[model samples]
Target: MDGSEKPPRGSAAHRVEAALLEEIAAGGIAAGERLDETRLAERFGVSRTPIREALSRLAAQGVLESGEGRGMRVAQYSREELAQMFEAMHEIEALCARLASQRLTLLARSQIEVAQAECKAAAEAGDLPRYLRANEEFHLSIYRAIENPYIFEIAADFRRRTGPFRAKKFADAGDLVASAESHDDLLEKIFSANSNIAAEGMRQHMAASFLRVLAAN
Candidate 1:
């Protein structure tokens, strides 16, 4: 299956949670900023019930932490924690690329191309949210190509933890466009069916990405 999330559910709480997560992934919310339920209720045009539910779910996921007076704040990580997470993700992604290149499914190839096109378009349009979503799907296409649920779940979890911090690197359309272009070499190596080439290419790609994120921090 493609990497797109399921169609929006009917539950208001679910919708709010997803929307907030997207904003978090887009770097719209900074760590340690308190979330006010009343303000969120006004922002999402929903009652406090859904907002509270959404906050509770994110808190459970470790994306948020308890704040002053029972409110919640965005989760923060120390530099070392960020480095450890990125290190794990880097190796996981490299392994996925190696396997994906070896096993190159037609469905995954098609999905990857589609996601890349979206990435380019969103980058050109300078839409950070759109670009971030497209970027997620693009990498997910590769992870799915490996056809291993365990690796996929591990990679996705790492992504969930670092998406916001990773997003801080892109400050403008130029940054976004450059990031999208950086995918080209990795895609070529992945399509080559050379495991070593694919893995190394992915490792380099992630190295550069981590450096950018580090600089942003």
Candidate 2:
């Protein structure tokens, strides 16, 4: 039997880093807003050492810009940069879907179907968070079905980085409905075991989402 999962407890540095990342994603720390280590340390009830470490890691991740005297600021992206990021992710995810279609086991496909049902129920109930969680589970089910650890890792990372922004776009009712339809199409293609069709379907789904983001912005 599956045991109950314990909650995560982060170290001081990790707490600071997570809070800072949340601020950035929420737009509380606007693009180019300077990060003051002292202020952040105090706010997070941590020391300067952890704050600095957090800032350094964020800078390395391209989430912040660091300079000798200027300290750090939230990273800014141009429209072109956003487009490029989404385009790269589209290609990667398409490949993932293709592989998943070719290799998905019956058990994995059943899990994906269950996730989809949950998503539909969430939508019907107007539960945004539940819908989002179920949506992620559905995609992840497909990723695991592919059985390529490296590909799954890369796709998961990319999805995590973009998730907050994507969630914002899907807050609209129309977008939510459209997204459900897209998932249906994706699942159908996968069920048919047509890797090429699945790849194309995944690409189109991502393209639609990217367009929605662009339109929102």
Candidate 3:
């Protein structure tokens, strides 16, 4: 099987959680800033229930933390925590790349090409936000291309925890361009269906990415 079958989409609560997480990662929501459920509900144009559910999920994922007076705020990461998280993320993504290289079907390859194209366009246009969004999709395409649901789920979970720092990399235009170039190399290797080379490319990409993020921080 091509593993190109689109996985089932997440629930509304999950969508809301993703939006909030993206905002947090993009620095729209500052660390230690309280997340008022009522305000978030109003802002997202949804009821409190979904917002509460989203907030809870973020908290569980360690993206948010309990605050005084029974409230919650954006979670901050220490250097050690950040390093550990990125290390784990690299392993997870590298494994996905290896599996995907062996299992990718024609359709899966096409999907990844589309994401890489979007990434290139965004990078050329100097659209940091668009590039970052496309970058996320590009990586996700690799994860899904692996055709292993359990692996995808685990990688996704770690992504949520480390995403804020990963997203922070776009703040540097030079880094953004470098990342785009790296994606080109990565896509070429994956499309070649060389599992070892693809995995190595992914590992090197993550190493470079972590260094960039570490420098930025």
TM-scores for all candidates: the values are: 0.86, 0.71, 0.86
lDDT of each: 0.86, 0.75, 0.80
What is the C-alpha lDDT profile of model 2 across 101-195, one tens digit per residue?
Answer: 88989888888899888888877777766677777777778888898899986776566455555666675666666677778988898888999
What lDDT does candidate 2 reach at residue 24?
Answer: 57
For residue 51, model 2's alpha carbon misses the true position, in angstroms, by 6.9
Q: Return the lDDT, model 1, position 54.
A: 80
TM-score of 1: 0.86
Point out where model 3 deviates above 4 Å. 1-14, 22-33
Residue range 68-160, candidate 3, lDDT tens digits: 887888887887888998889999989999999999999899999999889888888888778767887788889999888999888877765
Clashes of 2: 0
Residue 159, model 2: Cα distance from true site in angstroms = 1.5
For TM-score, the strongest prediction is 3
lDDT of 3 at 140: 82
Q: Of the candidates numbered 1 and 2, which has the greater TM-score value? A: 1
Q: List the residue pairs that clash in candidate 3.
A: none
